[model samples]
Target: MSGTKPMGTDEHDAARTERLRKAMRCLEGGQFAQARVLIEPLCDDRRADVILAHALAGSGRSTRAARMLCRLAHDNPTARHPAQDMMTLLLRHSRLEEIEVTLRATLRQTPDDIRLYDQLGEFLLLHGRTDEAIEVLIEGCRRHPSALRTGNLLAVTQNETGEAQKAQALLRHLLSYHPQSAMTHANLAHILTVDNRMDEALHHHARALELRPDDPHIHLNHAMTLLKAGRHAQGWPEYEWRLRIPGRLKYPAERLLPTLRQDSDLSGQRILILSEAGLGDMLMYLRFVPALVRRGARVTLQVPREILPLAARIYGVERVIDPLRPVPAHDWHCPFGSLPRVLGQTSDIIGAPIPYLHADPHKVLVWEDYMPPRPGLRVGLVWGGASRPGVAQAQAIDRKRSMNLAQLAPLATVPGLYLINLQRGQHARQMIDIPEGMQLYDPMDDVRDMDDTAAIIMNLDLVVSVDTSIVHLAGALGRPVIMMDRYDNCWRWQSGRSDSQWYPGLRIVRQDRPGAWDGVVARVRDMLLPARPDNP
Candidate 1:
């Protein structure tokens, strides 16, 4: 203590870096005041500007942060952090023109920067400019020949945009050049899985796992492959890795119920099941509740309020509460998605079947005029699924699952079918664009929730929809439904089958090719107007 030494340049720099890290952690936790205090001292350091911008934004000065980030991005054209942070901020505000200008100007300033290309491609993709996004990513790959991520992005975009063969070829080429790339292997596995090439997909998945044994993403992909092929026993165990993946997990692993053995008895025990994922997932998995209830266990559901009115009446569900309520006293707590893994011993049990969900009699009567109270066959149509703006993976899936309502113009001209608008969210606006002569009965403005939707659905003769929550609602209600299945089907639909394994008698009109909904629509039209023809 008696001897004092001055801090050298390296030690001083190290101290500043640690301080910046602490500031970043504070920003992540939204302790904006503390982050600002820690970061203001480092304003002169270029590395700290993004963190400072975030701190400034969270502390009631978003405009200042935006201007600061824009200045930082313009000043440091080749730097990744400022540009990416600025892009993220611009996306949240949907300032499309400014985002394009900033990214293009920065790319011109530093054409060799790979991160700018990725950022611009992502921005374009988010805005539904898929063609431009593909071109940008392709050029990025051409320029940065050694860049793995750009090439992967191009391949994935190609796959999603109805060029599956081209995507497969590009991935194979990437593997030839970069044989050791685990991501390329995993991506190839996914494409093959979607193509129904189960054995080949499993091989690539195994290779990916061997290369990166602890990677949760590879493990999750592997799980999807096995489950898609109906290898449930193996799939369920690998699926446990989902809890370890970031963003996918809704709750902490410690709080989740431990694995319940196949033979274990929960006689008189109470269990709480927490909801996870989108409404469609909730509807699909809720069928398993009866399997749990049959074990002499009392089941409580913590779910979205939208489903509360319907879930409250499921045969075996003892109680249903909105997620805002504190989890009531229970012996075991499990994620809603976990029921299948824990209760596979009773696999044959399909729970309560055919109209497991019922509409309120009053709501049904109220909706008597919902579809023109006539003798004509009424059909419900849902052209789109839910929107998840910030979630890139989910957004990509939705693009594939959704279609323009205009494509159904062919059916608008069909005979004796009264099309009803069950479409919701931003997609419902497409009702105005339907064929001029076709009148769609829309009573959705007054509809409240799933229970209300179910009541309306019961008034229809059948439901016709894409892979949306509406399909699950119709199927679970035991209503005849024609699922407009995408070419790359979901895992539950299995591979190359017209009939559903889950919903028997559910007619599936699958696309002959990816993003080729025209074929599907044509098939559905033909089915509706069968060759038997007692008509005009």
Candidate 2:
């Protein structure tokens, strides 16, 4: 009790101040137990109490921390840090309803804070509560009609959620008022590019780049625009700005190659190729490693630990390193994303072999033993992509590209076609709800990573999947793959192309409308009929 209050003396007050500061320092350094011990004594102050709650949460006492946050929020609705902290904690714990209540309560007490509206709307959108997000964002825009950031978010959301006309109208209206806004131009460029309006999209992208020459995000957007339009010669340079964008990749210290040139002779150059982005991108770019090897470069490849066995089998890879460990000694290092820019402008340098990835022959033989005895075309199905809830933009794109297993249940009725499940991650639970009759050959329960997946894929006749890493793996193996694509698909697939430029055996079944997967499913199902073993 005595520790909770300062003695009525200058010496004691000074000691208390020092103690609180030390506790805050501990919290900031993530020493949660130490922070809790120090902050508990000075819990009389609201700021001290907030620190105590943070320490509790950090120490894994999330329920207790959440309760304390609720009380603190109810007592002082205008406290900025605690409310934001509570939102993050609740989101991690999936206590979503409370997040909305706390956000609304904070906004009510401090109605003039425009940031609260933005936070609430973004939270709703991240969780896929589209209607609520739209309402909140609309109200926010109405209240602060001149606010470009919120309006831009609202317009993007509208475009994604089946209201493209409304989104276009909002962006154009915002542009009429704020003609000089770089964000408005960039977002409009995004929507235009998605609709295949190449000329208009490029113009807006140029305008945005002209307005904000140093903005990495705008440059990345413009890069995607050019790449999607198949103008890769011009796009590769713009795409280099992706390295400058925030949260793209993790680099270790200042050890990377200072510069690389396309025409440089690589005779005996020790090159370390680190993964730049997603696993799919790594697969896409590993094709160029053969070229590096042919150039007399000793290529040491670092890939995701799960794919180590598979990556080790690439034709010209001198060494395969695990991604979890620190990068080993090398003369120069290059991330896979930079490979296209370094290798060539539009065309890949020669010697990137087709079917560069191969499964272990023994593993394939073992998996073949577990295959269905019935003589039929073995078709693998991957109905969903990874649900990356932590990254909002990635999650939003996943929602558009992935579909439930139920949407693909109709394929089970196809004669001489047996469906195999090749999906993992949070979405794998959909297998339990497989619509009664769709018997899936789900060897995923025993599969560890891409190595195991590749082994199993070798037993299948075809792989049908949404846009995910599996498609890359299948394509790399030179297997026939039917990719169920979104309307606004990746730049690699390009525009209006059913055949892939990268993989000869891969076929794309694209959605005609945004956020529509039924058409994609139907096309895949219809196309599979000809491939059925009993069709002839």
Candidate 3:
């Protein structure tokens, strides 16, 4: 048997290698549990330590993987990449203590390692230890000033800690040193955007795009900047790509309706106005359905059932289909927001007609008596929207978008102005401090649907809001509205236009810079100063 033994005939050795390879394949296929089964026999194998570390990491025992990575890194200093990878994972898990411990140990072994310092500093920032992250990164950057990772984090953390100018300097320095990294350009562009330097931000974003055209995040950021700069010709197309983002709503591939691109006469054509995104988006785009009908096509408005009754009424359509139902036959379908793009709209070519909707006479009569007469100007206000997922994250007024609310305190002080609370929801809790008598009514008790909203708006002299759907509703109903906006405003507002092209009676009050509610409020105040008899 000894003489018959081959050069490498150890059964266990062959089996171990095969099992490890199978575990790797299982991991690659996303079967983590199956991978663990194959990995159990090789726990003590030095050759399989990294694989074991990765498996443990997948199992959520990342601290153990991190320790294994640290030991491996100490023994094999040239293989420090694994250590950096583990640090990144730990940072995501918010395991700050383990990160700090591993980083310190690695730093002791290779004090001059810039990558180690960078990882440590980034983790500190992720954990909200911005001051310490800044200190560590700055020291490392001073030692190895040209290291992009160290310099980038130092700059970002500095900006996070309220030292934007210093952050800008570091980023610009890195850009000057290494102009090829799209990441550096993207970071610099974001900082510039936050600093209210639109021109510089645009330039940096364009540069980043030049380096990496297909990067979706950079594309989204650039599109936002363009929309903010009032350059919508390029923004919407980039914005459309947002559907591809994880957890974002996906319209069917058939929504584009290429098969219906035939030039056959529209005398019998079927058109579908598919709702995709938010209630506001649905309402905003419903204006185009009439145009489709005018082309002799049979048009159907597909939307969430909650808004169907109101949309059908305002849009003047006989058919409003719920999207949750099986789609009926349609020759063509497109997203609600795609109307402008499909129609090839530009600023000068856009047309807006007000009061496109009519409230029921009965509802109007009900509100007419329910609403008290105002002594002077009647200004309707809506401080919140439904707490739908979209509103909570995208449209809801947070501390940043809501500086106008605080500024309205001064508006209340202006005599001959009856401020009515069309506001609703838990967000109304923010208005508890508003002085009494400024409020004319709180119709929220009866305001449940668009009919109620329209009745209340029709009775008011004017509406004032901060980028909520009520602004759109008021504008659609031909009520004069002054829309307050933040620096990073929504795309629908367009950039820099004092008046909305989408709503003829709507005037915009945008921050001269982002987050400057004081200036926006002051502008609105100046426009509505105590009316003289001559002006009135």
Candidate 3 TM-score over all chains jointly: 0.71
Candidate 2: lDDT of 110? 57
- Tell me the TM-score of model 2: 0.83
How many clashes in candidate 3? 1
- Select the stronger candidate by TM-score from 1 and 2: 2
User: Number of backbone collisions per candidate, in order?
Assistant: 0, 0, 1
Residue pairs of candidate 3 with colliding backbone atoms: 487-514
Error of 3 at 271 (Å): 2.8
lDDT measured at residue 383 in model 1 versus the true structure, 0 to 100: 86
Residue 242 error for model 1, in Å? 1.3
Question: lDDT scores for all predictions?
Answer: 0.81, 0.81, 0.69
**Residue range 17-57, candidate 1, lDDT tens digits:** 99999997786665767988999889886678777876666
Candidate 1 CA-lDDT value: 0.81
| Model 2 spans with C-alpha error above 4 angstroms | 1-99, 109-113, 246-263, 345-351, 531-536
- Per-residue CA lDDT of model 2 for 1-536, tens digit only, reads 35666466888889888988898788666676898899888888788888887777667665566566656766865555375775675566565665676577656665655666778888887767889998988988988887687899899999988677788889999999999998999999999888888889999989988899999999999999898998877787788788776765456436554434555567877889986678888888888777777767888998988788888887777899877777667877888877777766324532265798899999999899778876898998887887666787888788888898888977887888888889898778987777867888878888978898999999999999999999989999989999999988888898899988788899999998887888788778788785556543
Candidate with the larger TM-score of 1 and 3: 1
> Against the true structure, what is each candidate's TM-score?
0.82, 0.83, 0.71
The 10-residue segment of model 2 with minimum total lDDT is 344-353
